[model samples]
Target chain A: MPAIVTTGITKSFGAGETRTSVLRGVDFEAEAGEMTFLVGPSGCGKTTFISILSALLSADGGALSVFGTEPNRLKSGDLVRFRRDMVGFVFQQFNLLPALDAAENVAVPLIIQGVSPRKARQRACAWLELLGLGAHLGKLPSELSGGQQQRVAIARALIHEPRLLVCDEPTASLDAETGRQVIELLREVSLNPERAAIIVTHDDRIYPYADRIAFMADGRLTHVERPDPARIPARPIRGETQP
Target chain B: MLGIALKMLFGDIVKMLGLVMGIAFSTLLMAQQGGFFIGLISRAANTVTEAQGVAIWVMDPKTETAEGPTAMRDVELYRVRGVEGVRQASPLVQATTTLRTPQGRSSAAAFLGVDDASLLGINPRFVVGSPEDLRRPDAIALDQLGFSRLWPGEPLATGKEIEVNDRRATVVAITEALPGFTAPVIVYTRLSQALSYVPGGRNRLSFILVEAEPGRDPRAIAQAISAQTGLLALTTPEFQRRTIDYVLNNTGIAPSFGVVIALGAVVGILVTGLTFTLFVNDNLKQFAVLKAMGLSNWRLLGMVLAQALVVAFIGYAIGLWIASGFFDAVNQPFSDLKGFWLPWQIAVMVAGATAVIVSLASLIAIRRVLRLDPATVFRG
Candidate 1:
């Protein structure tokens, strides 16, 4: 079964004359154990579609399911629980809280789930150790470089072990080499038979890592294709499971 | 999460200082003004409070306060003394006169003339000399503040000669008395000398200070005296309360203090509300990111409340410390503000006001948070 499946997902903003349609109808699917990249020009409704898929937003009209559960039909409380237990997100800004150290920032999800803070920090430390950030765990986001901050954001997203990871423009702020490294780390640690990852990006340098690429323009998915396998780099997998 | 909230608030030093200062200034102004008002109003009843054993005060029906009395005929004293439950009735006179120091300086002074034999209404805590010293010829007792004002550099000692209403008077004792609202200089002398010194009509007795029998209720005795003698009579507490009420209702002191206190609260509310709102707005994006991470709106509300409470508590503590310190410094001996103090009730009142301030500010700021769209995090 697909990890996420949506048909005719629609959303709009404002009212009366100023009503702007950002997502007319978006139909998309991603199976478990695969990395699907949504590629499009700016304002193509790519972010809105992922937001709907992850339950960060509600669709004006659509049928949506994540891992056999339809989110729109769930009660408000149930929907919040679903988002908390099943979804993870990474933003383009690497939005680590400026006041918190790296480990504390990465510990946010588990803390939100009501885990003891001491244990959350322990788990966060293990994740940081796996992602080559063990030396930077005590440093705040502003104390680290762009690549390091993005790594901390990725650690925060995956620390809860959610089945569906959604990342929007995760590498747009990094250089080519560091961006490729982050994507490599995200896939090696996040993909398995029980989980899937979806990344929204306009950065073409990381395109070879996507198993399937969906193109969006003008509020709909225009095309979906399998990328050439030869262009993908083969590297030994590391940090495949929770440390 | 609450821990995170506190960390967030304390992380910005300049903003935290601004918030603390707003609350502190409000509290200080409120407490200080309230203390001053209480101290000043209490002075209106100082004579009543200082008269230790006088249970009932008998005056002319038109006399409302202790400051200015309509003199009753000397025969009215005998009438009050004949009332049932009146153990001892003594004639007490209150008058104002001008005093001239040996240095040739002059100032107005409040005069109290007690019964010469019993000295029933002249009870005072002596500061420098014994009460026995007032028994000497032409002797008078001066309040410590008055002595300091009349002789700025002179030590408080006996054998200081002064003139009252052109009559020679000597300061034989220095007594500690609560300063009055209008006159800080208080002079205590015998009834014969006060009548001889001040120019007045044939009626000389200002009040009859009646001490009720041990088992008698002072209020009942006062009522009996009033009914039989055709004079206004009141228990000590009643007279004190009436005096304070007269000061509050008939004077501008209460309104003046009230305006200042109201302005302090207003300034505190405005400063704290605006600064707190700005603080939240600056961190709005961070809050949105938390919301998008599956934190419930309820938990987010709790976090905001936690931040607000922390600020209020810290600010209130600092303000209260400073205000109490002011009261302590002024309450020293020889200071004109010797009787002023910060009451715990005022602290509690300021605390309640602080709560209202923070709640209003948090309500305004949290509306923005509650209405925030978590999807906006994706926009950045």
Candidate 2:
């Protein structure tokens, strides 16, 4: 089974006279061990599509199945548990809780998964170390540079070893060099045979790192492509489960 | 989670400080008013309470203690002794006498005249002179407080002469500090000397004091006395209640304290509610962040309620401290006003009231937090 499948998903904001459709008949899928990219200009519904895939927004019309379970069919509490257990999200703005230190921010996913704080901190520290952020674990988000904050966000996304990682413009706020480093980290995380990542980005500089790239126009995906193998290096999967 | 709640509660020191002060002031006012009211009520009954071994007080049916004079026949003393529980009974005369003093003929003095045998019912702690001193035909025991007013600069020596009812009487001994209704008191001879001062014949007395058998209920003995003699017999509590009822019905004290107590309660509820409301509003963003982190609505509410509890407890402590200082500095002089005495139960009640007020104030903010869309954090 695919890591994520959405058939004929549609969404609209407001109601009646003021209703405006933001997504229409969007069908998408991401395979295991693949780094799929959704590239589009501003206001093209790339972020909205990722939101639905991450279970943060409910599609008005769709069959959304992540890891063979329908997200919309779950109750409120169960939906939260499902999202915490099955998905990790990295946003464009690096939405780290400002009051928490870097390690605490990275531990949030594990906290949501009901891990004890001590165990969660240990796991988060390991991820931060893997992401080259070991020295900055004790600093707060405000104290870190943009590049360091993005790395912390990336560490948080992969801390719980979620089956599917949904990232919305994960590298948009970083410089080209820092953005490339972040993309490479995401690419390495997606090398697991049973885990996948769907990243939404407007920046074209990081497209070479994507295993498969899907282009979106307006509210629809218009094309898909495989990046040149020479431009991307093979990476060893460090934290994936064997299936 | 509770630790998180405490951190949230104390994180904003300014708002927390405001809430503490508000609650503290309310509690302090409540404790002060309640204590003073009780102390004032106790003063009206002190005269009767100090008289020991008197189980039943016989007063006229139409008379209430402290309201007006109650006259009973001196002959009723014999009838009261005829009851089963009654061991002895005595006729006592209470009259207000004017004494010529350095303070321009001092105000009316509470004069008690009792037979030599019944004088033991008076305060045993009489300072300098014994009750036997009042047995002398021309002698009287003056209260210690009375001498300061009567003599002013003169020393309170034994056998100092004072004019009572324009008749010269020697102060045989000075009694301890026993203040009476309206002013300090003097104890004089009961049989012939006391009756001669009254306008009527010596056969008339103010009231009869009845002593009952050991282990007898005062109320029951009072009923027995009232049944045999056609008079109203009252226990100590009943007498006190009658006096309090008379004062409340006849004086302005009830209305004044009643209004103050009511205002205090209203201000307490409003101030606490408003303070807590502003506190919650200020933390709305923090609440939204917590809600977005998958915290249930009930957990968030618990945190807010915990904050309120901490504020109330701290406030109550400070308020009590302030009230005690006020009482020590002011209230004890005019009346026998005592310090604030708060029981554990009363503290719990105050805390419960504070919690209720805080919970109501938090409802609006809690609803807002629960309804917050987690997606907003992503929007900006």
**TM-score for chain A, candidates 1 onward in order:** 0.96, 0.93
List where candidate 2 sits over 4 angstroms from the true fold.
A32-51, A89-158, A164-236, A240-243, B48-50, B65-69, B90-116, B120-207, B245-271, B324-336, B343-345
Please provide TM-scores, in order, for all candidate models, with all chains considered together.
Answer: 0.96, 0.78
Question: Which runs in model 1 stand beyond 4 Å of their true positions?
Answer: A235-239
Best model per DockQ: 1
DockQ-based CAPRI category assigned to the predicted complex of candidate 1: medium
DockQ for the candidate 2 complex? 0.25
State each model's CA lDDT, in order.
Answer: 0.88, 0.71
Model 2, B193: alpha-carbon shift in Å? Answer: 8.6
Pairs clashing within candidate 2: B24-B315, B127-B176
Query: Any idea what lDDT model 2 has?
Result: 0.71
**Cα deviation of A122, candidate 2, in Å:** 4.4
Q: Tell me the docking grade of candidate 2.
A: acceptable
